[model samples]
Each structure stands twice: as structure tokens, then as C-alpha cells.
Target: SQQGEEDPQALSIQEGENATMNCSYKTSINNLQWYRQNSGRGLVHLILIRSNEREKHSGRLRVTLDTSKKSSSLLITASRAADTASYFCAPRDEKLTFGTGTRLTIIP
Candidate 1:
């Protein structure tokens, strides 16, 4: 399977502003998972929206998947300093494909 990559590679925004990141894949997937890794912490599972689902939300986070476009997007509302982390998306399969991820900086 081909690895999907995150768009914008990096983003910076004020603490209270919303942040959005896009991920695009090369092949079909069963499900797509989103993750966040703080400076020194392990990747934290954020959202796992399936191929049949269009949107899912967890707290201030929203995930939208458009299988037709073979793409997904992650939106973080009411961002905070703690939101400063690298976000990654992976496809659920026997061989998982996860890209480098998008680095987000929240300026206080």
C-alpha cells in the first residue's frame, strides 16, 4: 500500500484560533485514524473515522473523511498551547501506512 501524507507540513496559529490539516492517501483504506504526539509523548489516538462515515467528533476535535477524494481532514477548535503537537493519519490495514505528519504550533 502507498503511504498517505499530511498537507501543509506545518502550521502556526494563535491559541484560540482553529487549526485544520488535510491528509491524502494513494490507495483505498478500511478506516483512517488520526493521532497526535506531543514533544516527548507517544502518539495519542485522536479520531478513527471509518470509510462509511463522513464525520466524527471528539471534544473540540472534528474529523471529516471523503473517500471519493481519498482524503481526510482534521480540525481542532479552540486551540490551546497544549495543542502544540505533530498530527498524523494512518490507514487501518494489515500493513499500516503513516506519514511524517503535520507539525502544529499554538502561540499563546
Candidate 2:
């Protein structure tokens, strides 16, 4: 399990605003992925950035990876109340390991 710790355990924001969360890992990884979990449900894959890639974006979500620092960040643009959930980063070589996630609350 290469997944490490994530920072700022939680966050709150207003709708139409942006939310950013960061993650840090301790070992070498092939790629990093971000996932979103609603309340007590299963996680859904949001985005993935490879070690060779610096940044990636999907819809309103953006991801950045800094391999030298063993850290990554996820940014959600124009957030909505429905976007409120827990976000996690999984730094993986072969298997995915999830760290403590950041809980985001979006005020409508």
C-alpha cells in the first residue's frame, strides 16, 4: 500500500466556488488517482494522473501531481451542493490504497 496521508481533513465551501484538497504519499508510485465517496456509499473514480503526467482535468475537476514531493492535489471548480463528499487520493503501483480523505461540504 503506497497511499499516504492527506491534508486538511475537511473543507467547506459555498456553491459555485472551488474546492481544493491535497494528498501526500511516502513511496514511489506508478500513478495517482482521486475518488469521491458520497456519505456512506461506495467510491467513484474521479481522475487519474500518471507519474509522467503533471496535470489532468475532467469536467470541472482538475488534478495535479508532483512526484518529487510525493504529493498531489485535486481541485473542483464551480462546486455544487451535490458535490459535497469525501475525496481520497490513491497512490498506486499495482494495487490501490486509500488514505484518510478530505470531507467537503458545499453550501447551497
Candidate 3:
């Protein structure tokens, strides 16, 4: 298992519903970060959780880190159609190593 590999490669949800995505990594890390990408554009940083932290939140996004399990999850509350995008988790070292993203689609 490589660092920052996301699960359930794709997801579809209706507007106002919540979306959750999970990422698992192989090695110990200093920090884990989540990002969102619309279409082919650049990634937008959502949240970053340090290995010492258990959870964090920003806006409608909630991020959880479980260092013991080497996993992290992202939760998006009250999802909107505009929230449709590809989400990724990356492990922070000297540089970030991003895994394949999970594509989320919000239906109207």
C-alpha cells in the first residue's frame, strides 16, 4: 500500500446529502492533507491534519486522522451540486505525494 491511497474511487450523492471519502497510507507521516479538484483544474486544499491531531474541521469539511490505523477520512456536510469534483489525500513529507483521487458527483 502506497501513501495516500483513497478508497471507493467514485461516489454519487444528491444535493444536501453528505459525502465521505477515506484514505489509507502505508508509512508513518507527519501530516495528511485533503484536496479538491474541479474538472481538469488545480487542486484546492481543504484541510490538513497533523499526525498528533485526531480531527479537524474547516467550513463544511471535517477531516479525521487515525495514526494508529494509518488512515484518514474526509466528510463533506450539506453537499451541493457545485461540490462535484475529484478529491485526493496526500501525505506530507519534504513534498506531498498525492494518490489517485476519488471522483464525487452531486446530483440535483
User: CA lDDT of 102 in candidate 1?
Assistant: 99
The top-ranked prediction according to lDDT is: 1
Query: Per-model C-alpha lDDT, please?
Result: 0.92, 0.91, 0.91
lDDT of 3 by residue, 1-94 (tens): 2458898799999999999999998888889999999997999988889999999999999999999999999999999999999999997766
Off by over 4 Å in 2: none
Off by over 4 Å in 1: none
| Clash totals, every prediction | 0, 0, 0
lDDT of 2 by residue, 1-108 (tens): 677577779999999999999999988999998999998899999998999999999999999999999999999999999999999999988887888899999999
Off by more than 4 A, model 3: none
Candidate 1 lDDT over 25-48, as tens digits, reads: 977888999999998888999989
Can you give the TM-score per candidate against the true fold?
0.95, 0.96, 0.95
**Model 3 steric clash total:** 0
Ranking by lDDT: 1, 2, 3
